[model samples]
Target chain A: MNIKEYIDTANKKALERMASVQPILIDIELEAKNIIPGMDNKTILHAGPPIEWERMCGPTQGAIAGILVYEGLAADLTEGYEIAASGEIKFDCNHDHDTVGPMTGITSPHQPVFVLEDELTGKKAYCTLNEGRGRVLRFGGWNKEVLDRLNWMKSVLAPTLKKAIKHSDGINIKTIIAESLHMGDEGHNRNRSGSYLFLSELTPHMLDTTNNEIAKEVFLFIKKNADIFHLNLSMPHSKLIADAARDIDYCSLVVAMARNGTDIGIQVSSLGREWFTSPASIVEGLYFPGYSEKDACPDLGDSTISEVIGIGGFAMAASPAIVSFVGGSAREATLRTRRMYEISAGTSSIFTIPSLDFKGTPVGIDIRKVVELDETPLINTGIAHKEAGIGQIGAGLTAAPYDMFKDALKAFGAKYL
Target chain B: MKSNMNDLLSEGPKVINIGLRSFYEASETQGIKVVHIDWKPPAQGDIETIKLLDRLL
Candidate 1:
């Protein structure tokens, strides 16, 4: 067989491996460092590809400072910022640590993380618990309110969830995501449906595991924060499937695409951990009353991982309601999904869209198709305020840079040909 | 003579707007049927990148 045959077979094998993954929410860990590979007491895991403190964006730096205080390493938020800049802290990519995080993706040891295991392979992925809406740490808001919320999660929320998930045995994340798409969640910027489904699934178990008072508190917390509460679960579930598809010889399928506020990066299946990066793009969408485009950060967060497996932006056709939040017409939403099929290597058998006549969501972003057709992967993401201390101002859509895909394709030629 | 203008009046001129959604949207507001296609020059208009992409399987 020729090179085309070899590549075709390898891509098929990679997609099959990805499809075999069954991500189950196994348990919640009180301390992430105990489980996340290479994570230590002083290490702060961030999103996207790797970068150090000096080059870190405002939100990322702000998050690191707040996490330092939250971890008790610093006397106060000021000292936390000082220590972060002091080079005493080691910042690494969450993706490199077998974990994933939301905007700024600042995760420390003490923060509670949900543990997900790919039942097919026993491979696990972790993500810090989501901190609901505005004035939260993920969007760079760090203060008494933010740290207080973190403390509540670590002391109250995490332990309660730990018990409830244990009592339920395990909840299948793929099932929730598959159902969420049908109910108007693309599993990235909009996860209200997924959050509702997750809470409903775990509520009964919480009653059995914890006292009624504690169960009621946890239930109310999730209920009010349903806006993006399920995003943490979706991130790791995407990572698990992407991890399962990694490192196939001659496979040009993209396994991961993430942003660290400063730069956006992607890793193709055969490229292993090598990152092809470019400056992150500015998101174009509506903003809340006071904020404007100038106030928003360049595309931030590892949440784009949702688009890695063809949900999020790729399945926009499934969620017309998103147009109101992300700034586009309902027709444009269906067009987005229709266009993704041209670039994807295969359609997901598990996640299907109802509006599109139950067609599988486009899966497996093939880099060759992207560069050849000049179409890049787009993700629906939340907008972070460029300045620290301000949380999410809005939600919107953004596309990955084409230069990264071109560079990845060039590297693929040098490596295989 | 049966003119071309007569033909356009009976069968409206179909508009296929390429590369800009704004243009198609403007036409739609006027109650004209139009289709929008998002397009761009392939490979960033870089000939070398385009050629390299083709060479790889």
Candidate 2:
């Protein structure tokens, strides 16, 4: 087959797989060595593709130190630093272990993870719980307060959520995502609606499973942190969808987009696990009161999974409220979604936007279309501080570099057509 | 406006391009037929008239 014929056949198969996926939240489980295969005391799973400790960005290193402190392997920050540098702990990519996370994306051995399974394909994916917002370990905050928060999440929150999830017989994540889009959420930076939808489904179960006191506290915590509460659930949902559509021969669909503070990398379906990387670009948008562009780190997180599955930046038209943070107007949001359709293989059958006349969100990012149009995928991301321990500075928008797509196209041409 | 996307997409739809020829060129590359509308400011760059028209509209 010629190039176009090959791409047409591959894209048809990719779109079929993408459309067939049904990501359902199956259970909440403790992340023990037995649960996650190959997980052990020394294993530390960080986000994005693999990188050595010496080359790890500030936030990732800070998160590692924080994890050590949380696990009681280190007495203090200084000790934590020593332990990390001494190579006592192993660091690997979360993707390699069937897991995903938000910023910094650290998944220690004992952390609790949500188990998401695809009902159609029976493939599963996992993600750590969201640590709520500021001064959390995900952004590399390693203070006593951060460690205490993790302890509470691991002890109090995880067990409570586990009980609730059991009582609810596994909340349908796909339903929450679809409803959230209609109620004004793109399921990435702006998850207010998604969070509310999740609480609505989870609250009744929590009420039935737990006592009033603990239930009230859990409810209040989720209610207060509505913006990021849905992120943990959304990440694994995206991962399951991507996993279902992945590994098709000659398929140029991008299955993953991720960043460690130093580099942004993407994996294409046809190329299997090979990553095309470029230096992470600085984000441009509004910042917090005491921070500026100089304080912001490059884009970081596995949250880009949401974008790959076509809801985050690709469904911006559904969430106009995101503009206040991501530095664009409502018109621009709609335009961005419209433009994405040009480069995508097809529209999603599940997630639909009300503002777009109930049109399905664009899905299946075709690398051939990207290079042909010279348009890169836009990522809606949270900005972490350049230094560890500073937490989130702001949230904004940035595009994957054009060079990454160009390089992927060249590789695809050489390997396939 | 409730768009009948099916109608628009029935025969590999025609695009009504405005403001940029590059958009038309890009669409053409994807086998999308284009009909360019040569859009220009109504009052030929008259600031006062444009401001008045904005309020009137």
Point to the candidate with the largest lDDT: 1
Query: RMSD per prediction, one decimal?
Result: 2.1, 11.3
Q: What is the Å distance of residue A139 in model 2 from its true position? A: 0.8
User: Pairs clashing in candidate 1?
Assistant: none
Each model's lDDT: 0.90, 0.84
lDDT (tens digit, per residue) of candidate 1 on A1-417 = 777788889989988998899999999989988999998898999999999898988998888888888888988878988999998888899999899999999889888899999997799999999989879999999779998889999999999999989998799999999999999998987899999999999999999989999999989999998968999999999999998889899999999899999999999999889999999988988799998889999999999899889899999999998989999998999999998998999999999999989999999999988998888998888899998888888878887898899899999988877
lDDT of 2 by residue, A219-279 (tens): 8888889988899999999988887767888787999988988888899998888889999
Poorest 10 consecutive residues by lDDT, candidate 1 chain A = A1-10
Model 1 Cα lDDT, one tens digit per residue, B1-57: 378888778888779999777899999998888988778777768888777766764
DockQ of each: 0.56, 0.02
**Candidate 1, superposed: residue stretches over 4 Å from native:** B1-39
Residue A357 of model 1, lDDT score? 92
The per-residue C-alpha lDDT of model 2 at residue B55 equals 32
Candidate 2: list runs displaced more than 4 Å. B1-57
